[model samples]
Target: MTTYLPPEVQAGLDDARKRALKKSQRLSVQAGEETFRVLEAWDDGFALELAVADHLRGMVDLYDGPTLLSQCLIVASEEDGDQMRFEYKRMTEATGEQPVDFEKPENAPVALIGKG
Candidate 1:
């Protein structure tokens, strides 16, 4: 059997799917002082709402809610409808500060057991 949905029903379903995706992601991009909701994210790059001008290039930070995921230098890749794709020029994971003490013999030159 085959079933077909009305045009309006299809549109409503599509809108609901988009909203669910955005809510499930819980991700945002911080560019300068402005933040934008991320439509989707992958290992090498991510997509943002098509709000900025074309050919955007700069450093942006990706965040999972309040926690920062990484700092990335991005170049606009393409635009699909209301979403814009960006490819990462460079990506650096956010690192935490570590205190070093030269006075301690165990930490004389810093530990490197599993830092490879």
Candidate 2:
């Protein structure tokens, strides 16, 4: 089954996804024992939302392939016009005061390819 999405945001999301898929930008986020996907990323932290039956606070690790990117606290948030997502609590040595723009073609994480 397919869900219908209106224009504007959907169009932009589709375009960004297409570009990201081509570059193989796969960001792996690890929290506790479960790992989630990064929908949006910044210098300090990344954003992710999963079917979490409950919310808890803990350290989250973001990785690009085998390399560790950021390790920080994650909290749950459900705001208006936003998905029930989790965000990094603070910035670490990986990310400085200035936020680095991700989701861009040049700065997006690279996806890993495997053989069948």
Candidate 3:
């Protein structure tokens, strides 16, 4: 069963879908000098439109807007009509933030215990 929508209505739906996709896809991937939007991501992998995935491989950087998130070596994992998934052969965090180890002596605050 199929319902026909007027051309204008169909166009409006298409526009809305595009806007939603743009809003939801907050991350981007950089391969060499080119960049592509990441449609979705997880700890091990991410997806991109098949057209974009075609040009990418090996080492790439993932970014959240202008901030670098991680560097990965990605290989194709799956593909469907319009999208492809990539699994990380390797991934490393690119963020400046480091995990805190409060127990580490170097991380402890410096103080003169008797002077205080």
Candidate 4:
């Protein structure tokens, strides 16, 4: 069965969609064995993205791989208008290994892996 959203809810979704499209930016990350790409980031603190398939399995293959799953987070700075920063992190996992840490530190090298 298909149920429709309430009018108010639909309106809210529409507004969010407009805002997201206006300020959307792409982001990518390499965590453990898999890479992640963030499709969009808006002025608001919401990120629309997806994780690479087989990421967890690839990590398991690595001896020193991160046990936690990797994700892409959006960081926005008004000072750098229209430019959103991509932050990477690993969430807690069932395994015992520590999660991979993600941060934006000065002097971190920025490179383009390839064309999306």
Better of 3 and 4 by lDDT: 3
Against the reference, the lDDT scores of all candidates come to 0.81, 0.61, 0.83, 0.40
Best by lDDT: 3
Residue-wise C-alpha lDDT for candidate 1, range 8-110, written one tens digit per residue: 9989997797788788888888888878778888887888767653545699888989999888899999888767888899998887855567545664666
Clashing pairs in 4: none
Q: What stretches of model 2 exceed 4 Å from their correct place?
A: 1-25, 43-45, 52-56, 79-82, 94-116
Using lDDT as the yardstick, the better of models 1 and 2 is 1
In angstroms, the error of model 4 at 39 is 15
Error of 3 at 47 (Å): 0.9
User: In model 3, which runs have C-alpha deviations exceeding 4 angstroms?
Assistant: 1-19, 97-116
The candidate, 1 or 4, that scores higher on lDDT is: 1
Can you write out model 3's per-residue Cα lDDT over 1-116, one digit (the tens) per residue? 88999999988996686467668988999998889888778889988888657657899999999989888999988885567888999999885767877657766677656755
The TM-score that candidate 4 achieves is 0.21
Rank ordering of all candidates by lDDT, starting from the highest: 3, 1, 2, 4
TM-scores, all candidates, are: 0.71, 0.47, 0.68, 0.21
Writing each residue's lDDT as its tens digit, candidate 2 over 13-108 gives: 967864564355577777778866565665544444434413545777777777777777877654323324556677454654566575457766
Order the candidates by TM-score, highest first: 1, 3, 2, 4
Model 3's alpha-carbon lDDT is: 0.83
lDDT of 4 by residue, 64-86 (tens): 13333333333332222223333
**Candidate topping TM-score:** 1
